[model samples]
Target chain A: MAADRVDPIHQFHINTIVPIHVGGYDLSFTNFSLFMVIAVVLSGGLLYWATAGRRVVPSRSQSVAEMTYEFSASMLKDSAGNEGMRFFPFIFTLFVFVLMANLIGMFPYFPTVTSQLIVTVALALVVFFMVMIAGFVRHGFGFFKLFVPSGIPVALLPLVVAIEIISFFTRPVSHSVRLFANMLAGHITVKVFAGFIFSLGSLGALGVAGAILPLIMVVGLTALEILIAFLQAYVFAMLACIYINDAIHPGH
Target chain B: MFVTSAYAQTAAPSAIEAHEGVAAGGGHEAFPPFNPEYFPSQLLWLAITFIAFYYFVKKVLLPRIGDTIENRRRTIAGNLEEAARMKEDADAAVAAYEQELADARARAHEIATKARDEARAKAENDRKKVEASLDGKLAESEKRIASVKASAMKDVGSIAEDTASMIVERLLGSVASKSDIAAAVKAARE
Candidate 1:
């Protein structure tokens, strides 16, 4: 146990396992990179293995894989209609990556890649660019129409458009921060309470009895963190779909 | 292992000095993810992994699953359509069979009636011919009887004449003329 230091932020540290210097830049493969790779591989391997059989009546694992597909697909369809199916693969990839990363972080010794701002920002930027490109490609110059609301008084149009544009640009930032903050906070809270159990035990014979409360808190926090992991992943994917809807139907 | 790492970081005087030195130089040591040093690497790996996974899902897995679902739907729809067509064909066949059976029954009845009528007409014609032949025979017999009766009456008349002549001969004891005898007989008969 890292109960002595009791610094929850230490878990987010990126230690380079293999340092690589490229053109005077430190591009090392750290613990963060390893988990990111694990997330990708696990998600890809699961889908491939489940769909390899392709039985009409799905097997247990196949249903799991199909359920994931249907979940992301329906989420996109519901937010953006039939046209949203074009981005199903991208949104699904984003979902599984974040989900697997969060889930693996719940275990000991595994770091949460989604907890890192850089990683979440990277994923959000992908959705951001996809929305922009899709918007421009489909609607051309009319993509700028996304900022303009219909039935607004002409006098207030400028202010409303400015607010809409500001909000639009902030999409990626808020999208990334939501997932990153949730996972980071939940893990830190659990770690802090876990440290409490050990710190109380070390005080004295009488302090051992006091450790029971933090111990129960740690147990409860673990369950809540697990739920947060799943919820954040779902929320991240759902918001991405909603943002993409703006691109597909710019007027809306 | 985690306890040892924590102890090593905190207990080692050199590690503390290094941390202070790095912290004094810049705030980069405080946040590793925000540090410019690791962003390129994280971004690089993320791109590679995400693109690979995206293609795997888009090109490979999705098509296979879609194919299975589509095939199942097509099979079910085709089966239902074929069953309906078969039902319709069966219904038509049943109707045709019933029609043929009724026609055959009607033809059989017509043939039976025609045969019975022919037999009755032939019997009627035979009876009429036999009646005609019987009538001719009866008429011929009746004519023969009439002739015989007439001849018997003539014989009876001759017998009476002879009886009358004998009576006259025995009573008068004289021979009479044939014409006179005949005339006396006619007067007595009258």
Candidate 2:
């Protein structure tokens, strides 16, 4: 029973050497390190190769690369307005990195960094920090006023501010958890159903018939995972846009 | 939001173990608290992604959108100019057609008027010719009548003279009766 029961979440653990005692902190790199490096190389190579010898009329590869660029540009413009153009580089990079990480994880024997809560949360925190900094930089002391609605009565100010602060703090948690949870759940489901098919196949005719159900489920779940991968990347980019919006227009 | 609840349900662990077991039993592994700082790969990626996207948007995407819009504007403007030119051409063609129609109408009127005048002149010439022929015929008839009148007068005179001669011969047989012949001549003259 112990061998038969597989822990889905255990597959996502990142094994590494604890950081060498440089000072007091462990700064050693891990499997997550290797995967991230691979992701960067893949993204860079693809983008560079696609755009290197661009003609007036684009080739298929160049058009795809350009489409990626345009898609993010339009998203930023719509969500964050013209000022969002300044953050275009950040948003585009985020989208590509997340996309690459998600796609790479779909391959056999590839680790999904986004499936880790720590990685996702850290990324979300950066966005959260940038949003706060941008708001403060633009509005100065008035940045704090974002928590309090303008038309609210003085008595209701405390209640609104508390709610706003709690919501604001939850942003990073929710953002990170969304990506991590989705990736983790999707991968686990795929692995478990795959295990079910193999485990059931060892039995006779009835087991063989039962194998078909898990096989079908595996195929269906795999297709769903691919969709979720794309969706997660899009959601990550979209949330970045929304956070940037707060910086550009704070009152709302 | 719907995804959040679903994730929460799936992620919930079965039970939470108390920490006091670690000090009392000393056999269980220490449970680590949730940490947000475990991953450095994410930071490196964040840097890479930020840099790459920054360059792409700056150099490629925005420019393409701008170009598309500019191209559309130019196309629209060109269409408008072409339409205006076509309208002018149509107006010119319509005006020329109207001018030609008017000229044809005037030409037709002129032709009808000239034909009517020519017909009137021909009729007048014909009436004059008929009147001259009638006058010539009347003059010829008058001449014939005059000659005939003269001849008839001559015949009548001759007949009378003959009759007188016969009467005289009968009355004055041989050379006697000169007074009788003279009286008969007087009677014939009276």
Candidate 3:
């Protein structure tokens, strides 16, 4: 019996496919890079294929492409108002990329790009910088008035401003971590349960019997993970829109 | 349920421990997404891919979709407008047809009324003409009848005179004068 041969954390290990060292940088092509490229190819290729025909009555691929476009357009319109539509291209790319990454991750042996903290942080930072730039460019120094609300009592002003400022700064942390932690935790839990099945199977007949519960759990968790995969993508995009909305309409 | 052998159970734990040691961050281990070594490459690739994706979608896919959607929308709107215009035209045509029918009906009724009035007047004139001719004929017949009655009366007078004269002559053995007989007949008639 080799019951303890299963390792759940092993799935997260990063391996360099092409080890390249430039100066002090480790710019090697990696599994993470591969999946990001795959996501890009899949998303971009599908979009290209979908709109290649440009039929008045859309094909299925065109319908999918149109729905994706409309989904981002409407999300921006609803969250950030009409003015936010100027950022449509950026938002659309962000949404489609995240969505593709999440969906791709659901497949076996495919890694999730958004699961990487650096990638998510980078995305969140893009939104954060955009918000600051847009706010400052539009409102100048008055953009700081977003921390202050209307009709507050004099005594409670300090407390409210402090809270608002802290919450405002926490946006990127929450934004990135929400996606990263959700993907990491869900995958890890699924892996741990899956590991249990293999480990218990090594205990012969009795162990196989005990493995049934973990097997069922693993199956249920996989389904849940798929749901989370879609949901986290949506949440990430939605937050990006909301944050962008703050820049468009400062002080409200 | 079949139980596993005790020896297998004991062996399983050792194997599991060896697996954990091998898995637990040895030189072979790359500590997942947090691995500082993978960050630069991932970010670099992400930037390149995302920027390309943004431009590709913005430049190519979105415009085509927009054209299709806008074209479909315009076509639907045009169709609706054309249908409405056609409906209005049809309504006008039907109204004109109905108006023409109403005018024809009114003209037909007027013609019928004029024809009826003319026929009634002709009939009245014919009746009056017939009444006048009948009156004239009746008057001529009455005049003729009066002449005939006068002639019969004169003849009757003459006959009565003759009969009286004969009767007087036979009885008296003398013939009476004609004038006297005529006078006696007339007096007796009176």
TM-scores of the models, in the order given: 0.71, 0.66, 0.86
Cα RMSD (angstroms) for every candidate in the order listed: 6.8, 9.2, 7.9
Estimate, for each residue in A1-252, the C-alpha lDDT of model 1 and write its tens digit: 453247666777777677665776556677788888888788788888987787877899888988887888899999999999988878887888889999999997789998888889988998999899999999998999999988899999999999999999999999999998898788778888877877888999878999999999988999999999999999999999999999999996
DockQ of each: 0.25, 0.09, 0.35
Q: Rank the candidates by lDDT, best first.
A: 3, 1, 2
After best superposition, candidate 2 residue B159: deviation in angstroms? 12
Q: Is candidate 2 or candidate 3 better by TM-score?
A: 3
Give lDDT tens digits, candidate 3, residues A60-117. Answer: 9889988988888899999999999999888888988998998888786677788778
User: What ordering of candidates by TM-score runs from best to worst?
Assistant: 3, 1, 2
Best by DockQ: 3
Off by over 4 Å in 1: A1-5, A203-209, B1-29, B83-190
Error of 1 at A164 (Å): 0.4
Docking class of 2: incorrect
**Fnat of each prediction, in sequence:** 0.58, 0.15, 0.75
Interface RMSD of each: 6.1, 11.1, 11.4
User: Against the unseen true structure, what C-alpha lDDT does each candidate score?
Assistant: 0.82, 0.72, 0.82
